[model samples]
Target chain A: MALDADATLGEAGEFGLISQLVAQLGEALTDDEHVLVGPGDDAAVLRVKHGHVVVSTDLMVEGRHFRRDWASAEDVGHRAAAQNLSDINAMGGTARHLTIGLAAPADLPVQWALDFARGFAQECASVGATVVGGDTTRADEIVIAVTVLGECTVSPVLRSGARPGDVLALTGRQGWAAGGLAVLGRGFRSPRVLVEAYRRPEPPYAAGKEAAEAGATSLIDVSDGLLAEAAHLAEASGVAIDVRRDAFDVPEPLVAVGAALGADPMQFILGGGDDHALLATFPDTASVPAGWQVVGEVRDGEGVTVDGSEYDGPTGWTHF
Target chain B: MALDADATLGEAGEFGLISQLVAQLGEALTDDEHVLVGPGDDAAVLRVKHGHVVVSTDLMVEGRHFRRDWASAEDVGHRAAAQNLSDINAMGGTARHLTIGLAAPADLPVQWALDFARGFAQECASVGATVVGGDTTRADEIVIAVTVLGECTVSPVLRSGARPGDVLALTGRQGWAAGGLAVLGRGFRSPRVLVEAYRRPEPPYAAGKEAAEAGATSLIDVSDGLLAEAAHLAEASGVAIDVRRDAFDVPEPLVAVGAALGADPMQFILGGGDDHALLATFPDTASVPAGWQVVGEVRDGEGVTVDGSEYDGPTGWTHF
Candidate 1:
């Protein structure tokens, strides 16, 4: 059952590559109590204890989402898992299972797929989730579709729940990914921190449930930067949001990178994406969790503003 | 919002295109009671009444799994939804929710994406499933990833439960897709039925629950040709399967196509795939459901055989 190191997907074949990838999941697939049936069947059966399952899907394409030259296969896999898992977190749910659908070239290295599985499994392990099933096919480029399932012990949080006078709070890394992208775009890789952030986002997985428990009015995954997602929250809730620019203390590394690249660090905090940070609104600052920092406020008007004004820069990315 | 019939996805923009596609879903997005939340949120919430979920995913690349020249976008979407919904049926579950992840070129016609959603929604509506959420992005070619979620009123069926002396039965169209593929390969399209079969497979969705209630031992989706999947069943159940070639009465279209192309209709019946037929092993002939046709038997040995011998031909497709 040992795979040859030099083998490609075409050389290993579909079932062969699948077996290797499944093997990479190891104990997560075999020992998960919530998995009634794992891979190899027509479908996977999962036990959802609370009767409510939170689910979401995300698509990541090579070159558009990531580059093999900039990040390893494992990094790509981890980022893929991280984004979907962040969606589950945004719903105030605990992620439980995932199903991946991958389309890659036949000449892709077998080890790359295996490493991707390893990284995906490791991320799932972090949140007590398991890779229940997947489908792999051949395409011209690598296209990954990830679907994550989670359980909500309480009523799941929604983006439309924010109310006027709510305090907006944030947790997890916010601008590091944008900084990394800038650094990568400029052909400088000295700042390993920002570069690693772009490669693998470390979302605040546990903070979501904590915010929900604290009776947060609304929650969202800040994947499209603070201002852009704030606009989404505002539109969904029919409320206005005012983000205080001075509230954010740019990390020393980001400041240094900004100085080196002649870019403003605050713009990254407000407009950069891929950090997968948790943005939630509480009744007041006192209700905000200890790890979360108060950075904005929900108001009666519409749209999002910086310091009560339209301070515009690059807001976020658009797929089309 | 009225979408311009001639507009491309890039011209329409991401949010604009998504809104149009969501509008295409119409009442299905708003009326489903099982969906506590739908698209436009970070994740969707589904109320699974049985506390158990049967889930599976499939990936379809434009050229690998389908061809735009041979089929319309609607056909491709229908096929994608069919393959995943058939998985839920194979597990003896009722499909309830679906999430689609799409990656296509930016210049793809807006109407094409809208038509794809319509076709997907139609297929889902037939089985009482709803498109709960999805992610759309850009890729060089069209790559679709579909995940289906279902609830099992009974214990979900698996492929490893068949015992010796089990009656192997089949339901739904077996080789029509293969016939259609053959017709298209040779640049002829007179037989509309066969060509349509390749475009949109009508899986016997309700028959799966019937088989489960009839005390079926094992079940599988015959998506990878009958013989190839029979081999899988045998390997999984630690038993052998023997197919009676005489049991198959090739349909008129297939027979005509076989004669027209100087091929054997039996080959299509035995080794053709993409029809999403249900292959199951019942404990006894008397236990087989009314709609099912007894085509084979599970024996005490290993591997699959046709009329007590190996009938050599193309078995099935391998992605790699």
Candidate 2:
């Protein structure tokens, strides 16, 4: 039976709303043979193909992470799932299952939650993952927290494995989301490419495993901007990284947006985040995998430098 | 290294506050042999001893699930951990790792987040679990979401396994938290037992495995009151559960609180929740393990009843 369009969470109730949302998962919920038990239970049971499991979690709070006016419930869900799944992918793991915890006000629409679940399921499906279980409760504002479970066939990559003389590589778009945000902030939505990129990030899920298989020295998810993530890898590995400004051919969309907004496109590539790009270090440039662009080089030091010196710009996002 | 007690999250910054909270995990982070990687990575890698894993997630919002005035930061953390751990336990699994997602306002005290981590670590330690990885961000209120990963040596007991003739049993105190909430709501804190129970539930973590070992046909965590959970078992198993009211002996604390408040102690036992007691169904009375009280029996019908009659009071909790 179709739920009334005007139905709110208070009217549908928790159990009612949950069932509706679970329906949104559809095939992804049961198609996974690894999932021994799905929802409507105390806990979900999954048969891990590999003995080793990679786990990560992320919280997306309304107003802080995304505003309801600017993004759809599906966009919110996709963003929430992408962040945690990217964490697992960064470890060279294939995501298997997701458990979500959602808190929303009573007046929230039930259809909105269902759409959120649909988006979450679709995002997981893109990487052959499933939504296993979750908990929902009432709160003053919407808070969506997702935890993803994954399996790594090979030794999981860590940020501390990088060493001096390593070649730095990146896969997936950089600064596209940042450019999209700037466009949205300026009250112009004509740049559909930027706005859509901001709405849903397309993280290169397969590149993580490919990098690991290609003998990556270290790997990290570039969610906190290229400069900040490079700094993180540097700090963890005790090696500095030097990004070659000439290496990057600024994408046409970003260039157009930057020109329109009177901003430097390089700043977006250097300081923008939310692209969920995979940043990895290889022992040599030849070891870097296909589909990855060489962006920088690792050196014996402790900080990130652009063109051998600091490029003055906001390095990354800080939640607080 | 001690942090300033008066420092807020905004003052300490995200990375600074995270390191402080991570320090609270202490030995749990490094001592786990199954954990290949802990925090400060893209994701935590765990070597699951068993091929199967049990996973669950829960969200606790400030003022909704708890109040800072009533619950210390530690208490909130403990409660959040307990809820997820109990889910794992309910599946007859041993918890191995936890990933937390926390969202708090910028002005929230750094000490509060640190204490929360301390409580989470302590609770995980009680079950030999470790805090693995998580994401922290800013929000208008405090939202703590926890996901626990566990392993079950034996097959997980499901709620749908109960037969009509199965014996219903319970382990752990029921309604204690409810009675405690009643006491606290009336502005009386003298009854330390009730108040403490309300602050943090003491679930019989071992009882679930014991029940599974003793040939439990079905199992559930009595988090939404005994009657409600019993009904859930019945509905899932397609049988009726008749709970014997006489099986319960009203404790002295509940009796005194009920008398003072002009309420019936039986109501708390029948309609209260949050104690996270384990409820299970055994094939026979002989199969019921020690430390478990035979509370009722399954019958050929649907729904739950007390003394073969419908309950007049509240059946259970509703979030919306």
Candidate 3:
């Protein structure tokens, strides 16, 4: 049968479709305190106490960002929400609210979208954030854009504040996500370590707060790789960093993936991206947290170097 | 010559590339005041006063949203920034800052990206907003996602709370953008008015603020056609709306496009989308400002009716 006229975006219409989708989402924000304004306005407003607000955004697209075959709708939603929240955490801020913009094909099952929403809510709950508002539209592919608002009690950590002779430390595992991706891409069905890494990336949320409280000079999330992010810190602070190869205590999953791929585990630790690990530079006398390992030191050089030399493999992910 | 590997995103790497791009933008936020923490941390923080914060986001995909042939990099940037800021204006807020996320192919011209940034900055300047923060990555296609943050001294206007017997009023012309799209699609170059509407939609920003000040019960932006938005008000308020066709003053551009496309001028007015006009419900005694025209009334019905009857033409934009 020919598609019904309403099936086309030109027919059922933008406003009507948006209203229908929005109606499906039950109100998460009460009309009381905390939320000054909610959905249905041009933008939702929340009450801020500390006078400063932390903000971050992420966009996940079909095919490029995630494959439907590899990840369920719920997994996509959870990952999308987690990534953005992790950014807030990295800044030593607590995520308070989020706004999502979703674009997907009409033929996709509505259940899929609902499932994604559920995952998003679950992830938000982990960090005490609520979905405040969102926009939904029809597109040829699925696209999820999430913006998160956060609150910080103390000052936020910046990349440009790392001084010469500072110590560099990292909290949380590295190369797990990249290793997991390699395993999945190669059609490895073992679901223990690699799958866990891919399904849920546990960022050191509490560690970031501690680092900030401990007086970190600079901080960044290891989303793009250890060395890659260190380079950023170096460039932003106008300092050079040297990573000690022996400093890495590679995780078991990364070692397993390296063995399977016939690759070096060190390469994954240094160059793999998307672990959501927190990398911070602190004064030389600052004590490292329990989970954090001192990996390098900042100097007045040029860029990130491994053992005072350039050790290059894959540097990290490139968008282009 | 073949493209150099280093020039590609895969070679430049995500972390290094982001660092390079961010360095070019330099520092926009102050070190202490507005920016408690700048980029390179997990997130960025900005300070705000004791006023409501307005936020809106939009996504523009290459091919689907805009063709490269029809719009330059600068035009796409301008349009993306305009649409998001307009949403804030519709809520009776002033645009303050914008965060952009861009995904483009690696081989794409760097100049194009720079031009896009310039365009975005220019548009933000027009609306009194700054390009605050954003993320950029490599993808197979170009995608521009923008989120704008606005501020308001008063409460924001919402799409709900319209009372029965309220007058429905609109600011700016309707259906001109739809007419412009028609002219462009048909390759008809004669009508400059229609073409301009499609290229840049002029939202009645000041008028929205005025409507809110004049005691509008509910307000919405006409991103999706007049009738469609009116339907939203009716559904949200549990009331029926009646449109007076005789009251509509069809703009000259829409009339010309209708003549050229052999379509009814009313079709463009009733169902055409993307005019970015402000639609609000006001009390009978409320004074309608200049550029705003009354075209309908809210009543104790269930749906919207044109001339006291159901409109059988296209309902609005569909997203399936």
Candidate 4:
């Protein structure tokens, strides 16, 4: 039934649909130490830590965030969870719980929802978070709204903490998703690795804790283009960041794919989006943790630049 | 600029739109003791209490949960906040923070967004909860998904905790919202009070705590019809709930409206949704707290009965 496209959400009914979701999620969760009460209740009761809980939410709409034709339902669920988890990671917190609200048409395949639930549960398990609670309702289009709560024992990193003389660093892939999107847009699907990267992003989940422990001044998740997000960090910290493009060697696949698609590899590295990389600022690159690459430096100014000047390329993504 | 109808979300751009919303919310918030980090960060960092935190999420979609014509943008925002808050309150927890995910058409007026922010901030303030974080995106229709985090020092109440001989009690108005919908559906604008109930429900926020303190065994928020929710409590608790309709003396205004429209007031009281009433079960009616009225009893059996018989009227509401 979970794989049947003919099984619609309406035919499944509300309670029945919820039962399937709860069953799938309940199986993935093992630790109840933090959970006092879980799903099938008015609200979930979570045993919170005393100091701080990092909370963030993201909305992924059907057409605006992802195209159904380009990605599977499972991929949609995975991307949604990955993007939000990266947000918690950027805050130097470990995600422990999540609640997702799903809005989809009544005629939507129940199989899609089941696959979505599977991906949601699987992602949470991968990060050691649990799907504590959620809500579902009928709508014209599908919308997945995920809110994640994290436990941070140490002082959480702030975007405003970066200062002059700080080194800017990055971890994980950059521009891979957008590069994949470009390939798909050009009717090229042979680059399976690039397309798979777009389908299932690999965020540097553990790098955040490592950076925080090693004394990160500030951090951000690279969901938007690298240049755009760097601008955000610059503005928040009241400092200028200078990026050296030479610091990054474009991955061979992306470079080859860019050449075939007539796209610029540098632009993919700088201005492409949805590769959930961790960007951080450290006072000294020598002490920087593993998996983190120092790419730039923060100075006493505003805005972001590449090689001491602003690069005239695509800066960010705006859904509208 | 916020009041200008011509100023649309797309015209404002994503960063600009976020700045406007953040400024408005920051201005509304006066305290930051509980907020480790607010908006503009990757995620909000809240000072979590040592005890359990109650969490809930709900999704409201245009044309399904609300009609833009029937509800003002502000009203939609308020109701959305209210419904989710009520769920937390129903669990006997105090709401502390909320994150909303909004999906709307690119052409939606910025003024409408401003109005929604105002209402959301105001409502959160009313309950001592702050708007911690949110997401915004473009879609064909407007969808507001809210997630609330709450703290409960005492053990959280569950719908499955009711025992035989427990008394059923209710707080806040019932069927008023449905009655208002009935009036509006008929295109009648004369009844101001009933219509206002539909636009913005005044949930009994304080009653939940009082009931919990007084020892409510089971509790639920009446988002669905009274009969429908009663059935839920019965099944979950594995007990029979016998509701006496005669015990609920229909308010004169509702009775008059029902009479005028040739509709049964009792039916409205039994089968209406979205009144946000707190329904709970206590060991005895004598212990029912203030602002609560005992209307029925939990007995040894299964299913819900109206005056010891299955209700033949509208049993529940299925939005689908």
Candidate 5:
């Protein structure tokens, strides 16, 4: 059944809704070269061109990850796919396929589920991924668990690989999602740019592969703010990082939105999470790819420093 | 820190709980040959020995799929993993790697979470599978989403490949889980075998590949009841399946449990679900693999028949 605007999921029924959504998603998300078996099977069959496969799973909760009042169903789907895809890409791999395990209240609108599949399918397709089989169940709140499978283009980079004297670099805008959240929290719906960033992230996927090919020592997606991620990299690699605040001197969309929210954009860049930007450390800064901008340098000690002093601002994100 | 008997997850904190549980599971679940990266990365990397991979995802919810009062934390984990692993096996593949997405109430005991991981880990190991990575989040009820990746031993079997005259066969017992559920529902905790059947299913994982090697025409795991699956096979293969109840005439645990409950065991066998038993069709009954019992025969028609007559029991299982 075609879901009306307000039709609840229970009214649509489980199998019928799955058939409708799967048929729609399968058409758009399938890559014949990568996918052997699609939905309506005991399991999905896929061809892994590379000998090794990269995989990641990320879960999003309705209230914890995204408030329904602040984000649309499409936004939730896209964000879920983006976060998982970004992690796979951060390992210097190309996105290949993905599956979703979704749970929502029976009273949820069926239209919301369809809209979710639409955005999720499109996002995976953008990364040349096929939608494999997944599970759906009933829940008190909407819980989306997405796992992405990716193919390696080069030797995978890990956080523990960074060495001393390596340059820390980033390839996408930071703090935009947090700024969008600020605007949304303030009840201003018109600052569509910030709100959009907060909803559907556009991570620099290709840059990760480029950095890996250029021999990046370590890499991570900036999902939990710059300083916080920097701290994780430092701890994992056993090296300190010196941040050059001047290197992030460019004035962009985040700076423009600062005045409207009455908040400092710089502070958001250093403290806010969910940007999903590609952050990496290169032994030679000159070898860093075109899109990546230098932000800091790996040092001998532990922890991170900003412009020759301690960065005591909000470090990273932690869920309770 | 070791969790006390009643220590809640929230008391352990998110990062701390993850660190402890992941440390525990990683020790038991990782194999160097199949897994390159384990729990501590953005995504885990695995070496797929087979050129192609078989993938399936299954999710279980608290109230709908299992109740904490009826099943222990370990049993829940094993059942969830068994469901996903069985799907991969049903495709004529060897289980290789798996990922989990877990959401639990903050007030849940940390010990319960650890036990769940332990059971989940052991079940995956039983099939020579390694745990890659997973996502853990907070929720009102415990939700487990398992995605299994398998390697094809022979050409994968499809549900639509059966032809007329193919003999339908099954490996492993049916209706045991339902029988177990019935026991649990009736508040009778004894009869450990019946309760165990409902909680931890032992699917004939090896038999799936064996059937394919012996030239089976079609295959599926009976997760949604035998009669329903028979109809599915018939519809998918464009043939009718005539089920022979007498073929399954031999006494087994299911029949033994029926007497205790004072219910028709045949109803559970035909209509009850969650057995994870391997059901397949071979071109010749004589060619059926060892341990497989012939249950029916395929013919030129649609739908399923019991002793050459239409079955009038419950058609199948559907999630709300």
Candidate 6:
């Protein structure tokens, strides 16, 4: 059972390696009612009062998902924590607990891990969530797998409820992150707005709950692009969406960045993403809440159109 | 926007890439009351009846998590699905939905991805769970990030409930996986049991639910080695645990493998892992279930001991 120091994981085998790793985690669950069983079981059981639970997950990887040179450990942690919690917000749930699985190279500084944890805790505190548990291990690169658990007192907002003729509204600006990326890639100094947008995405947390309360038909987050999300809404609701170009009030910083980068600001607004804006559809007569702007309308057509025509710039991102 | 076949994701940009990906996934949710809002906003919301929700996640990497050579695309999918669902069962919950995020090299054949989905679906049907949603992206290696959602009518079993004077019991065999792995590595073909154990782990699915109903004091799946899990139980319960070696009924297949490999069978029994057996501690007078066998006792000590002596075998897996 002795492990050879030079042995590779493949040589040692998967089951044995996993067992060894699980042994190192410190166990704290002990209250009779709090935890019915610990890590040795098939699944850990927990007790809840209201029975409603909220859940969201995000995955971060080394290099492709993040670059060590571009972001500090804390920034990476904050971004990772914020994005997942934002998903909970989209669900109209209040985040309460988180379980994180961190994979990093063994040579990574322990202090960096601590800093990441600190940043995660900071973001969690912002949303009144706690890091209840986590798993850590060594890998060729860093991968952070975070799952957030939330409690829902009310109904959660979903994507399939939009009806034809509903008004499409957005709460928060778009294109800033895309603009910021342009600045960063060109090694140009970013305007304040674009810089802040990239450093920490501001998800409209309160607005999501408000939209749910305001009888919104369907909702989604604009983590990708506005048109991209509109497509999701259209397909989900089995309706067409018509976005008016004149209705888009592009922020000045986005325009400035576009000018500097020789790109179109409208593309940033319509095709840009990572803004984490709450986009929801509501009845035309529904009272619009503060911070929400009407941008488009649901139509009888099947896909998303801009200004009565098909948008021909860029359709948006594709994972493949 | 029209995407050029020659364009890379970086050239398409993050926002553009996301939009294209989102456009392809059609809507799945339908009930008007079920979803207040759907994807497009900062988050999606769903209605939950008055029942506790269970959540669990697991991350699989290409080389480290699974070998494409060792396992078929279908086998990878099955293992990935099984591990996440097992976590829900550990929590005394029935899996209802799964969200998967797949990252792979673009050159990977599309058929592989499709077959993976088939494997995922087949596994989900086995446990009555469905693949609800997921994200897909390109990466250097194939990484599958799965988050499972479950519902429980009863209380969840947590790891913090073992009390002093509880009897430790296990509902399944151990060390067979490690033994099987050993056999596989040495190219021994005599023992089919060992090979099967390595291929598909058989966790005690129903036993977990039974133990919950029987009011087991504390429970954990023996994912790590037996002694390591005992340590977790002892630490979580804030008590010492003494595992009786004489009580352990090592399976004959495991013994044969050990004998063939010139390794100690006791080490494999006590330190081998991935059997996914349900282990629980209950009051001495409590009724033990059919598959469960009493193997240890809880006491006032602080750590785990085997037959009144500390075991010096492999301390379990370490990720880092």
Best-matching candidate per lDDT = 1
lDDT for each residue of candidate 3 in A156-233, tens digit (9 for 90 to 100): 787888999899998887888778777788988453676667666777777777888888998888877889889888
Where model 5 places Cα greater than 4 Å from the true spot, the runs are: A1-6, A29-31, A250-253, A256-262, A308-310, B1-6, B28-30, B250-262
lDDT of 4 by residue, B200-279 (tens): 88899987877888999999999988989888899899999999888897987788779889989887789987889989
Query: Where in model 4 is the C-alpha error above 4 Å?
Result: A1-5, B1-5
Model 5, C-alpha of B137: deviation from truth (Å): 0.9
Per-model C-alpha lDDT, please? Answer: 0.90, 0.89, 0.76, 0.87, 0.84, 0.69
Best by DockQ: 1
Off by over 4 Å in 6: A1-54, A91-96, A150-155, B1-50, B91-96, B151-157, B187-190
Order of the predicted models by TM-score, top scorer first: 1, 2, 4, 5, 3, 6
* Candidate with better lDDT, 2 vs 3: 2
Q: List the residue pairs that clash in candidate 3.
A: A9-B318, A13-B316, A13-B317, A13-B318, A14-B317, A317-B14, A319-B138, A320-B106, A320-B138
- Provide the TM-score for each candidate, comma-separated: 0.98, 0.98, 0.91, 0.97, 0.96, 0.83
DockQ of 6: 0.27
lDDT digits (tens) for residues B220-263 of candidate 2 = 99888889899889988999999999998899998988999999
* Model 2: how far residue B137 lies from native, Å: 0.8
Error of 2 at B211 (Å): 0.2
* Model 3 / residue B197 / CA error / Å: 1.6
Please give the TM-score that candidate 4 achieves against the real structure.
0.97
Residue B306 lDDT in candidate 3: 98
Docking quality band of candidate 1, CAPRI definitions: high
Chain B TM-score, candidates in order? 0.98, 0.97, 0.88, 0.96, 0.95, 0.82
List model 3 lDDT by residue over B1-320, tens digit each: 22332365555555555655555343444422555555555576777775467777777777767767766777777778778888887777787777778777777766566667767766776766666567776666777788877777767778787888899988886888788777777877547776677667777767777887888888888777789889988887889999889988877777777777789989988887776888888887456666788898999868999999999998676544
lDDT, model 1, position A226: 84
lDDT of 3 at B190: 46
Q: Residue B302: error of model 3 in Å? A: 1.8
**Candidate 4: count of backbone clashes, pairs at least 3 residues apart or interchain:** 0
